[model samples]
Target: MKIRILTRIALLAAASAASFAHAAPAMVTEGILTGGNGMTLYTFDRDAAGSGKSACNDACAKNWPPLKARDDDIAGGDYSIVMRDDGSKQWAYKGKPLYFWVKDQQPGDKTGDGVNNAWHVVKP
Candidate 1:
């Protein structure tokens, strides 16, 4: 009976670990802007003049939720973090803040792009 209990415990632990590992990080593509169950990726305007700061906040943020970073997320290239008013971490790339659209219903959906003539799709 002790052996069976131990086996069950081990299996449960393994399953938990697998679930955590399978969680996807915010990703960016030419189509999908933002999503749940994974990291939603977004792009910023090339002409946006900011030094690693996000201009979207409050009402603007409601439509375009910023892609948050986990504690273990490693910053690379121009990627960095911005502090939101609600004390959340927002991801920034090349000095532009990234955001996800609320209208995108599934993966590969780029419904947020060119919405108000300011947002664009993040390639790759």
Candidate 2:
């Protein structure tokens, strides 16, 4: 009976680790891209897609916080990583870097859309 219990515990631990590895930092929420916390994600028009870099930095990054990614985080599907001006990693989708508006106080808020005709929420 003890051996059976030990085997079951090992299986559960392996499954949990696998789930974390494949988990995406962002997901489609209400038909739009949102962080794991459900906050809306946006893209800047000034950021050239597929550049592997983010144009929003310094003061610009203050208002629109980049979707940060850790060194261990893996990118898959339409998700990718872009190096920031500070040499940090950020999450991107389809080559466009993702960000969050500071004014958004709660999840599902898209107050950052169309800001200065540049910022827009990522769809799908």
Candidate 2, 2-88: lDDT as tens digits: 999999999999877865775797989889999988999999999999999999999999999999999988777899999999999
Worst 10 residues of 1 by lDDT: 30-39
Query: Which pairs of residues collide in model 1?
Result: 25-39, 26-39
Per-residue lDDT tens digits of candidate 1, residues 1-124?
A: 9999999999999877765662344444444434354434566563254555566778977877788766655555556666666777776665666787778766776777786677787654
Candidate 2 regions exceeding 4 Å error are: 1-22
33 Cα displacement, candidate 1 (Å): 7.2
Q: Give the clash count for model 2.
A: 0
